[model samples]
Target: MNAIAAPAAADDNGLETGLNATLREPISADGTPVLGKTYTVPARHGRAVRVKAGQTIRIANPHGTQVCDTWIFNAEHLNEFLSFEHTRAYIDRIIPQPGDPLVTNHRRPIAELVADTSPGVHDTLMAACDLYRYRNLGVEGYHDNCADNLRLALKAIGLRTREVPQPFNLWMNIPVKPDYSVEWLPPVSKAGDYVDIKAAIDCVVVMSACPQDIIPINALNPLDVEFTVLDPAVSSHS
Candidate 1:
């Protein structure tokens, strides 16, 4: 599948800029409330929604430094498509410096590293935070994380959580150093800068606005995020 590269101007120094806002919706803690086709993502967390080909999903880091890891999967086949290993391999193979298109396992374009909105880019090598990782990180008491949200999203679609893999973290900044070491940095996204994706196929997109307060990533405070869908005509051209 042909992938359109997200322009470097869009994501200057991992900072969100030049994003035009069209709509805003609130996500509650219980879950994303249904508002027609729009989904509300609660504060300090994330959610996933299904989008058909030709549809577009727009996510905003309503509160800066809100890290959201996303994943796209074929709704029909469900077993194949965006694989984390493949995505990492692709990124490693190309060694994208900045402003590169991230491809899925099927070679389908998933997302472009359009805007970083942070001084440090999040790790593509590190998987999503799970119970195991949380415990290892000395935050065993924390039960809720991006992994839990993904599991819930899978259940919402009548799919098993185990079937899902680690998702791509959007807006989160974990920069790689010259020595190839990774470090988590504070978010560079402001109140409104958003990351937009146009679907290439009928797929389920999942995200978790990271709730980890132990680090500086969220400024030690979790805040709400917004999700919206734009008309194809507008989103594609805008």
Candidate 2:
């Protein structure tokens, strides 16, 4: 009888999960935000904030060329997040427009796109970049990525999610060609352009200033973006 060999184990990276500056710089100890105050998500970093139901979050593109990967999760349930696949099915489009309901995996509305000051071009097709992606891109060491940013952002607020769902890639311009090929391009939004998303339930919103300098998705440079949780009583969109 011949002995069978076991399957090879996968390669292991040295970094610990949720280990980064993000954990030390949460918007608040519990992810709650001060109403009407704008916070900056530094380049190559992520930030998480709590937006209560009926509150609107305005994400601003300060440089207009950077891509901010955005995610929303139910405060009570980290697993219940704004799913792009479910949202695409709900909205019947690839990019959501103002007034479209962003849905969750269970087909429930989690948030609504209230207003967009840009041309309304956002990508819902790409997965958040991870360390493995950077490895494939010939990066020899650990690189800051959106997937870990999501994890670190949640962990910063004493929460965790087993899965990283596709994000609503704000200002990420990936255009499909006539032959169905896609082109990774920079955002068309101008400086100070913003979008407002109103929460249907209390939720934690995470945004990462994507650090994909190798590709031109961020015009070969990543920059900080800004966000503010609006005062529901005074917000015009409320």
Give the best candidate by TM-score.
Answer: 2
Steric collisions counted per model: 17, 0
Model 1: lDDT equals 0.56
Residue 2 alpha-carbon offset, candidate 1, angstroms: 43
RMSD of each: 12.2, 6.6
Model 1: worst 10 consecutive residues (lDDT sum): 15-24
TM-scores, each model vs. reference: 0.71, 0.92
Q: What local lDDT score does residue 234 receive in model 2, on the 0 to 100 scale?
A: 75
| Each prediction's whole-model lDDT (CA) | 0.56, 0.87
Per-residue lDDT tens digits of candidate 1, residues 17-67?
Answer: 111111121143323334335554664444556667656667777666677
What candidate 2 gets wrong by more than 4 Å, as runs, is 1-18
Question: Model 1 compared with the native: what TM-score?
Answer: 0.71
Query: Clashing pairs in model 2?
Result: none
